[model samples]
Target: MNVLITGATGLLGREVFRAFQKNEWNLTGTSFRRKSPGLVRVDLSQPDTIHDFLNAHLPAVIVHTAAERHPDVSLRDPAGTRRLNVEATAAIASWAATHGAFVLYLSTDYVFDGTKPPYRPSDKPNPLNDYGRSKLDGEQELLSRAQKSSVILRVPILYGPCETLAESAVTVLADQMNRLTEPTLAIEDWATRYPTYTPDVAYTILQLVEYHLAHPDFHGIVHWSGNEGMTKYGMARVLAGQMGFPVERLVPNPAPPSGATRPKDAHLDCSALEELGIGRRTPFAEAIQAILHPA
Candidate 1:
């Protein structure tokens, strides 16, 4: 299978690229700054360039992972967020529709309001912040333009050693643990998100692509996430315990208002993906161990 992946340097995109490469699929990747052999440099913000690239490659599937993903950054710069997240996504979906390519957009659990636990695919989206709002706009545009050939996979926080978000947390906590000092300030009150390992998410995406190829009728939003849910503080404690760090270092705190209004709970249910026999929930301990010692 010929595949094109955007944001190839990102945590999830890199994993997807690796998965496809291992499967001996004809894979080409795109990145804005980072360059690698066989990787095409296509900035999504430039639709014309992306369109031309797509015309040249003519990939059977396009897995789009590029976006302004930082919630804090999005809150600070809504326009920039929209440019990359919404407009670029729409442009790509439009191009895919014209080229008869299946587009798979990587969405987020942030699309929901966070009022409910374990959000379903059919649930109405009530984004609480600009980041979520931008992503939702992209999702709606992709659905409207790409029609039945496109798939939208909404995932929650992804954890892995190479993952920026989780790794940052891990590194900070690891440093403190090494020094026998308490790592401070975890959000115990702000109940939010479960994490999917990068490999698991990548595997699911590959399966979804294959499924779609065999069953062209398969199209729509699918919730892909880890099986478990926990607060940020709870997750921290689990991580510490798994890594043999003192659990006393983990402290309960609240999420400060930083312009971005996050949903209290945005865990996604992956029954749709499970029904397809694509992916299962990975244990948190196993995920943490993988991060500490990747092999």
Candidate 2:
């Protein structure tokens, strides 16, 4: 089997790359800004190039992890976000459909409007920001274009094995805490996020891919998320204790996040994947410990 992973150098994509390394399949990873020995540099933002690029390889499966994922960044450049998130995704799915390749698109929890506590695969999405809207659009693009078996895996707030502490939304708190010379950050205690582990998600992706190979009929949207829900303040306190930083120094802002409007609680109902026995989740504190205090 030939498998292509976009954004192979990203926080989640890197782990997915590692997970597939032990497999027998012919695997190729794509990187944009960053380059490595095994990574093929490709710009996903250029929709015109995506078709020729994928058609050249025609991988049996494609793990489309590339996207302009930052909420504030998306808001700042809505056109750029849509260019990659929706337009580029459309090109990929269209090519996959014609070539009979299965696509596994990595989506986000921001697709839901925070009013809903737990969203199911069947729920109607009402995204609050440009990032969520673009992702939702990408999901629609994939479903409509990919006539072959495809899966849209919607996950939330990923964190694990980052090159820099500021790489992940979860680990960025540690960076904020590191601003010893500056005023403490007012971390959001308002919105609840399920900080899912990337290695665990990578494992789940491998299981899904293997299961999908046997059952090509397994097509549609599925949710995978951490069972534990916590606010930034809650996560910060955990990190503070782990890092030996004063918990009292961490300021908790009970208000909603300042930029890029977010849902209060877009907690995904991960039963679809969980029911298939194709999921693994590491506890937030436990996983964060490994990243913060790597032995």
Candidate 3:
């Protein structure tokens, strides 16, 4: 029951690490730069290190969560981001295939153009930004190299415990509301999105891993998203209210101009995962409450 997780210090990966550890599984986690006490310092961008790390540890399952995630950052440094997002993923998948390991890659909902309302696992991907394109490419690389042994979980905007408010999208709303002195702050009014909780995603991943352990032949793509969809403006209002900030302070804004083209309504059809009896959707309001008042 050994599981190795990449990006173990990240917002999502941390939850996965804790979930597996809670179940008393042997866990090895990797970090790129920040030296967390328990994480192994392995730069996934380096193919040699990835190859060496996998060959040496050869965990039963590898949860690949490390990536260049910011759309703006990806647009600014395509080469640097691709090295980690696409190339490193390919190397890990190839190595895992040869070593008889199962890989669970965490992907994003941004792979779709917002023209579509609800995207399914079978739907074609039409990414709107370099970040999305890079993530889609990583998905392709892993599946191509390790088709029979890997599972791709396409997720939506994630929020969870982080060192700072700026780290999670939902919390960032509260941060903005807290800092703004003006009576009104503009929030994205047009684009529709689903905000998912990180711990719920970790729960889904663990279930998939348990199934994989029993059925090694099981391999395919599935998606998990929060059941609710709201525009960023709506989310801002909700978060503002919870934080005791006046809901009137939030104002609607047209989609902000950005170097990256973002999807307007990429709400995922998580029915595929739901049918599996493992995709437990978390309520956004409840998750926000927990974040606002962690017990």
Candidate 4:
């Protein structure tokens, strides 16, 4: 079967790329900025290019992972980000509908306001920031346009192998600690985060693809999250202990209230996906070990 992966060079997309290839699926990956050896250069921001590319090589399934994912960046350039995250996604879904291709959109927990402790797939979304709003818009687009052959997976904060060690959410703390000449590293303690492993996400996606093949009638939204609920302070402390850094070096930094509001707790309940036997998670400790010692 042919599988297409957008943002194939990104942190999560790269893992998904390897996972699909290992299963002997014919894979085609796309990248906008980076020119990877196996990836085809397709800019999602350009409607003409995206449409032409999808029409040329219509894959059986498209794992749409490409987007302007950074919240701060989205805030800075809302219009530019919306073009790719919202409009581009709508275009992709429209094309997929016409081409009879299944689209698996990788969404985020940011769709919620974060006041809720654990959100479900069926829960109504109330986004707080531009990034979250854009993602929510994209989700709506997929549901309305590609309703018959679309699956949305709402995920949480991710950390894993990337082109650089600093690209991951958890390992970035380690990188910051390594660069700090000071003995202290202040981390945000107010917000609760579910730091998921990218490899585990990749595994879950592969499982979902197989299940979709078997059960063509299945198409809806699902939730998948890491087992642990941690704050940045907690994650930094764990990383410090694991990496032999001074425990005292990590300090608590309360969440700020003035700027772009981030949800205090956007953790998801994966029971929906778990019930279908597709929500597989890696323990945070084991994931930390992998981050520390990458083979």
> Which of the numbered candidates is closest to the native, going by highest lDDT?
2
Residues 1-295, model 2: lDDT tens digits: 8999999999999999999999999999999999778999999999999989997888999999999999999989999999999999999999999888999999999999989779998899999999999999999999899845789999999999999999999999998898777556678899999999999999999998999998988889899999998999999999999999889888889888788999999999988787789899888889989999999
Candidate 4 lDDT at 70 equals: 83
Relative to the unseen true structure, what is the C-alpha lDDT of residue 196 in candidate 4, on a scale of 0 to 100? Answer: 94
* Residue 205, candidate 3: alpha-carbon lDDT: 95
Clashes of each: 0, 0, 0, 0
Model 3, stretches more than 4 Å misplaced? none
Number of the top candidate by TM-score? 2
| Candidate 4 Cα lDDT to native | 0.88
lDDT of each: 0.81, 0.92, 0.88, 0.88
My TM-score estimates for the predictions, one after another, are: 0.91, 0.98, 0.97, 0.97
State the lDDT of candidate 1 residue by residue for 125-243, as single tens digits. 99999999999999999999997889999988776657443344333445455555335544454656676888888988888988988899999999988767776677777767767
What is the lDDT for 64 in model 2?
A: 92
RMSD of each: 2.3, 1.0, 1.1, 1.2
Overlapping backbone residue pairs in candidate 1 total 0
Stretch of 10 with least lDDT, candidate 4: 253-262
C-alpha positional error of residue 28 in candidate 3 after TM-score superposition, expressed in Å: 0.2
RMSD of model 4, in Å?
Answer: 1.2
Instruction: Give residue 244's lDDT in candidate 3 (0 to 100).
Output: 90
TM-score of 4: 0.97
